[model samples]
Target chain A: MKMVLAILISAILVDNFVLSKFLGICPFLGVSKKLDSAVGMSVAVTFVMLMASAATWPIYYYILVPDYTYLNTIVFILVIAALVQLVETVLKRFIPSLHKSLGVYLPLITTNCAVLGLAILNIDETYTFFQSVVNALGAGVGFLLAMVLFSGVRMRMESATETPKAYQGIPITLVAASIVAMGFMGFAGVADGIFG
Target chain B: MEKKGRLSLLFNGVIKENPVLVLLLGTCPTLAVSTMAVNGLGMGAAATFVLICSNVVIAMLKNVIPDKVRIPCYIVIIAGFVTMVQLIVKAYAPEVDQALGLFLPLIVVNCIILGRAEMFASKNSVLNSALDGLGMGLGFTLALLIMGSVREILGSGTWFGIPITAGRIDPMSIFLLAPGGFFVYGTIIAALNKLTKGRAIKRKSMGCDGCPSAAACGGAGTGQCPPDKEGQS
Candidate 1:
């Protein structure tokens, strides 16, 4: 129980996927312009992360690790790609409303490094299946947290008039994200204290 | 479309369409491994190898692949190359393998390789695609080198793991962290923008236009089309 909490806290706050790990930054900077879209993207990514983690864990432990560790990268990616397609099809057919909200971002999640990052990270950390699910959930939530905060910042940035030409777009957002990441650094010790 | 010369094709990725600084394709690896100069160089080299190999293969098989499944096919090809690179790196350069960690495998998803496959390699000859890969790979390496050096010097007072200013002066340790990576990346991009008079890479809009996957990622509402070219079309 304590270990789960530590993983959750560490994944969501201390070692955030976007701010700290730098995964899924394309969407972090791309779709984070509006609050609505940011929320939508976050939810979509979280769903996919959860599903990808659930799917990859069994494959890694059952099939890949025993004799085919070398095939990990190739196998995991194909699994993710296929899983995204499956999710997209199911969402379009059953949850049309949610699919509409997600739009192109759903397919984009297949390429989002955060999802793959979570899968690879689970193996790297040698987490069990249950722990992998928790970590993925935490990462998804952390990604959502970062996206919402960044969307808020971007909203204000869009309205600001004093921004210079060079710092107008990505450069400014990156700097802001840096500050946010620095703030999250304060949580680095929280997990250790609880789980150490 | 006018044909690009060999030299220009090679030089383009180094500066004009650099995967890291200009195209902003692979920021994940760019930020994660840049804490140390050697790590950055190794990551860049590994990605470049995968990029060049995948680009050539994709270009050669462009016509053979159907449009509907091209993205998946491209991914499979890219993943194959990444796996080869990962195994080789782990075997020979275990230190770099450790430093890069999960990122080595994550290279399969790096948009730069796929982006080049879709945009350049899919339409060009094998030789041209190879050159494009080489150029983009070197460009990525160069950008990583610059970022790594800045962070290493400021964060650890070291250059390539050798302490340069251990007792001479206090290093700003924050530069070694994630925030520092963002700050340095942003500063360098902004500085480059200033130097190029904002023409080096167009930043007039902040949408999917900068994304390598923008072409195939329709419905993000940013559209796959470049803004400036939209008016003419």
Candidate 2:
């Protein structure tokens, strides 16, 4: 249980998806201008990440590992693409409100590296099925945390008046992100300390 | 179709439409593998290889693929090239393979490759598509090279693993980390914007429209201008 807690904390704080691991950056930079869209993108990405990991873990262990490791890249990508389509359809049919908010982001998730990166990281770390799920959830939460925080910062930046012309747009946003990332770096050893 | 000049097509990618710095596609690999000069070179080369191969193939098969499922078809082709490149790199260049690690496979979903396939390759001829791939690939490599050099020199006091500043000054160390990557990426882009006087690439509102996948996504393609704008309305 403590290990699980450590994983959750580490994923959310220490090794965040957007801040540290550099996964899902397309949506991170693209959708982070407004808080509402950022939250919507986060929820959509988290859902896809959780579901992708849930599906890919078993596929990796039971089918792809022993004999066909070579096919992992092709197989994993196709599975993710198909999975996103499936999730989009189901959401559109059952939960129209949620779909209305998230539908725009679903197709984009198929190409988001965070989902694929999580699956591969699970295999590389050699985590079991349960741990994989925990890690996915943690990663989702981490993505959410970073997106919300960055969106808030972006909102503030929009109202500022002292910014120079050259450093106005993405450059300023990136500088802010760098500071946030440096702050997150302070959480580096907390996982070991807690689990040890 | 009006034929574009071959030279312009090739030159456009290096500066005008650089996949990394200009289009802002494939930031994941750009920030991840650029810790060292050599890793950036290797990653760029591998992605370039896949890009060129897949673009040519896609251009040839454009008529054959069904319109509705064309995205998946493009992905399959891209994945095939990526897997081949991964295998060859593992066997021939073990060092780069280890350095790139998960990112090597992650290239299968790189926005640049898919973006080119959907936007350029599917519509253009095979030869023109190949040239586009080459130009874009070189531009990507150039950006990675610049970022990697700056980070390595400032962050580690070295260039490509050789110590160049052992006694010169204390390395900032942050430049080698994630924060450093963001700073460098942003600064370089900003400088480029200023140098070109904003003619190089326009800084538009971010979201699905700015995204390379915007051409194919349901949100932006269906007349919605990203949800951020949606909230304003």
Candidate 3:
């Protein structure tokens, strides 16, 4: 039980996906422009990551490793692509509001490094099926936390300087990411106390 | 179809369309591996190998793949090349392979490789496609090396892991960490924009209407915008 909480905190805070491990940075820098859009992208990514880990865990342990681990990457991508497509449809049909908001971003999830990164991380650590699921959820939450916070910062900075000639667009956002990454490092010690 | 020329392909990748700086693709490895000069070099070589292999194969098999499953086909080709890279690296340079960690496999999904395969390789001839991949891969490696060298010199007070400032000066440790990577990446990109986009920026200053499809100037001239499927897209 203690290890469980440790896993959650460490994954979400101390060894963050974006800052420490550097997994999923493509989305971290790509989608983290506007606060609202960042929030939306985070939610969608979190959802896909959780589901991706869920699906890929079984695929890795039961199907791929047992028979043909060589087929791992191809199969994993196929599963993720199919899952993203299915989620896109379900969103379009079931969650109309979310579909409207995340219309195009849904398909982009198919190519998101974060989701694929999470899938690989789960296997790299050799977590059991259930543990992979939990870790996946934790990673998704961490992605959301970082994405939302970074998004909020970028949103503020967007209107902060009237867009300087030098630090105009992507450069400014990168500076914002630097600050966020530094701030997130503060959580490195949190897992120690709770887990211990 | 116009017989694809080699110079056009080479020119497309070098100055006009760099994978990292201009297109903003594959920034993850750009930031992470750019921490050390050796790692940067190794990564560049590895990516170049995979890119060249996958681009050639994809260019050859382009006509055979269906439109709907093109993405998956690209993934399969890329994943095969990545696996081959993994094996070759482990066999020849296990240390570098281990250091790269999951990033070696992650190359399978790199936007630059897949982006080129989808946009240029799939549509162009094999020879020109190979040239395009080689040029772009070299350009990317060059960028990574420069970024890594800058960060290593500042962050660790060394170059390529060799101690340079020991007992001499304080290391600007910020360049070694994640925030450091971000600032370095940002500064490097800002430099590129200023150097290359002077005309674009000037036109914008003179108010030349909307953003001049900033991509063409920064993309392989495949008669299209940035393949939409580029970047994290």
Best by lDDT: 2
lDDT of 2 by residue, A1-196 (tens): 8888888899999899889989887778888887888888889888988898899999988998799888888888889988988887888889989889888777777788899999889888998888889999999999999989988988888999998777777778888888888989998998999897
lDDT of 1: 0.84
Q: Give residue B140's lDDT in candidate 3 (0 to 100).
A: 88
Relative to the real complex, the DockQ score for model 3 comes to 0.44
Among all candidates shown, the one with the greatest TM-score? 2
Question: Model 1, stretches more than 4 Å misplaced?
Answer: B1-4, B218-233
Cα error, candidate 2, residue A22 (Å): 0.5
**Residue-level lDDT for B85 in candidate 1:** 93
CA lDDT of every candidate: 0.84, 0.85, 0.75
Residue pairs clashing in model 1 are: none
Best to worst by TM-score, what's the order?
Answer: 2, 1, 3
Ordering by DockQ: 2, 1, 3
User: Which TM-score does chain B of candidate 3 obtain?
Assistant: 0.82
Instruction: For candidate 3, list the clashing residue pairs, or say none.
Output: none
RMSD of each: 3.4, 2.5, 5.1
Candidate 1 residue-wise lDDT at B120? 94
Candidate 1 lDDT, tens digit per residue, A74-103?
888888878877877787889988767664
Interface RMSD values for the candidates, listed in order? 5.3, 4.0, 6.6
- What is the Cα-based lDDT of residue A46 in candidate 1? 92
Model 2's alpha-carbon lDDT is 0.85
Count of clashing residue pairs in every prediction: 0, 0, 0
